[model samples]
Target: MVTGKAIVLSVLVTLSVVVRTASQLPIPPRYDGFVYKNRISADSVLVEAFFDPLCPDSRDSWWPLKEALRYYKHNITFIVHPFALPYHNNAFIASRSLHVANKINTSYTFPLLERFFRYQQNFYNKPTLQTSPATITQQIIHFALEKTGNSSFEKFVLGFQDKSSDMTTRISFKYGCSRAVTGTPYFFVNGIPLNIEETLDFAKWKSIIDPLLAEQAQAYT
Candidate 1:
């Protein structure tokens, strides 16, 4: 009994409703990392960093990043993603060690990363000794025990190495590749790529981040 016009109107209304529902749904968060400042806020800006612990450039980048973390501690959440480049001989093993350190205790993540960066040359320059996967794994296990003073952490690292370490490393590497990351020390602020030059300059970083933080503050006011 319905007229053609009424049928068309009903279809249009249904389609509009579907579109509105889809638009209102929240987008899923991308980029998982070792999260610092784990609070959820509408105004909070996320800073995601992709780095290899052994890369000199990544090590250099950490100083400025530390300064930024101090300056923006209240307004931002920082996430560290390990992207192990193939060229770095021990990168994969080093990244897996970081994952192991994070699993045993999140507190150890930065320290372990710092240790690896600090001793990277020593790890690289093995003249008489051959650095196989098992050798590196043992070295990390020993390093973790020495640093953490927790003997139980050894079992966790060994288990991770045997089962999930490679998978976890690959997943992080693939995620970085998907995002078009081709080098170490890449950063994303609020899902946008942050310039390397800006990363080192506090004034430049503040210029980009302050405006976003201001917008968030205005919304509350």
Candidate 2:
């Protein structure tokens, strides 16, 4: 459930092109799990990551985050939400494509995400400044279809052009707004926002997540 005030603030976020902090926004009313549940008792941690498909910072975070996930395995439940920043041109297309991928094949979503991050440079403001939206759409369609492998091209295009894609992408943005995620790569560990000012590595992430797992293990006994 989104409040009127938060809705208004999220609108204001798009009026500017620069990425800004949204500390003033109220904490969202709810945060149900997007992926796996907690590791232990009520006091346990749930890792939730909000990302923009075309944001570089979000791309940088994925490496360390993936490494940490590999190390922790089933000991953690990490949820990923795509929060496409408005300032980045065609970001909505990429984000919407994610939902389309999920509809076609949930398993393809991760591979599609990796492809988006790797090729983000191609879709940036400057590179695509002269490019038309139709052309970009085709590029995205091709990229996504290739990732989906045997997925029908017709279905891919149909899903991409569906109104539901836009709605789902907007829902993702609004969800991020509810969480006061004003910028890209917003992360919350156990509902507490992580400081991402510095580059994060597996060690840095482990320093935080390892303890939570340890505490959960201690309590499980």
Candidate 3:
């Protein structure tokens, strides 16, 4: 019998080939404000993540990841790429919505992602089995508008339909593929992929980050 993980992996591999056949897309932009803020020094550790918006693992990882990003704010640079897995029914639309949020306002990116994580259950395959794509898109837009008050509804709707926004989302997915990301909540630290199989926690994050930060503090002193 095919295991659940095997089935998911099979679909992911097949999807990767399909994406490779399509036009190559850019590496999704990283949050660059950290550089301008003088937050990143030569010693700063870079943490990059690829997440599926409707993925349960991604949602579970968000809290611990956010904590590390916050507590080590000055010592690390964090970038996230939204990768929509083929297995999740609305993952593409939700990921596309993130690009639209960024287009509307860069600051809206993580907030919208966080909101997606919170409301992810509603968009799961079973729950949304009967839901239309248009309805799903509207729900995502509505959720986005709720957290970020006063954002233009028209712009959000239009952005959703724009080719560029959708391309960017697919680009993000393809970007993750280039990195050989096979599953949700994949992570790399300082360009090295973390082969973690267990749940990530504060202690585990510090285990990787603190030593690097310590060396940085020592080197600068």
The most accurate candidate by lDDT is 3
> For model 2, how big is the CA root-mean-square deviation?
8.8
Candidate 3: clashing pairs of residues: none
Ranking, TM-score, top scorer first: 3, 2, 1
Candidate 2 lDDT tens digits, 86-151? 899989888888888777766778788889999899899998999998889888888887788745
Model 3 C-alpha lDDT versus the unseen true structure: 0.82
Off by over 4 Å in 1: 1-31, 37-40, 125-129, 197-199
- Order the candidate numbers by lDDT, best to worst: 3, 2, 1
- The parts of candidate 2 lying over 4 Å away from their true place are 1-44
Badly placed stretches (over 4 Å) of model 3 are 1-42
Best TM-score among the predictions, by candidate number: 3
TM-score versus the correct structure, for each prediction: 0.77, 0.79, 0.82
Residues 34-140, model 1: lDDT tens digits: 77645445567988889998888888888777787788886788888899998877788888877777767777778888887787775664541476777776776
The TM-score between candidate 3 and the true structure equals 0.82
Error of 3 at 133 (Å): 1.4
What is the number of residue pairs that collide in model 2?
0
User: Residue 108, candidate 2: how far off, in angstroms?
Assistant: 0.5
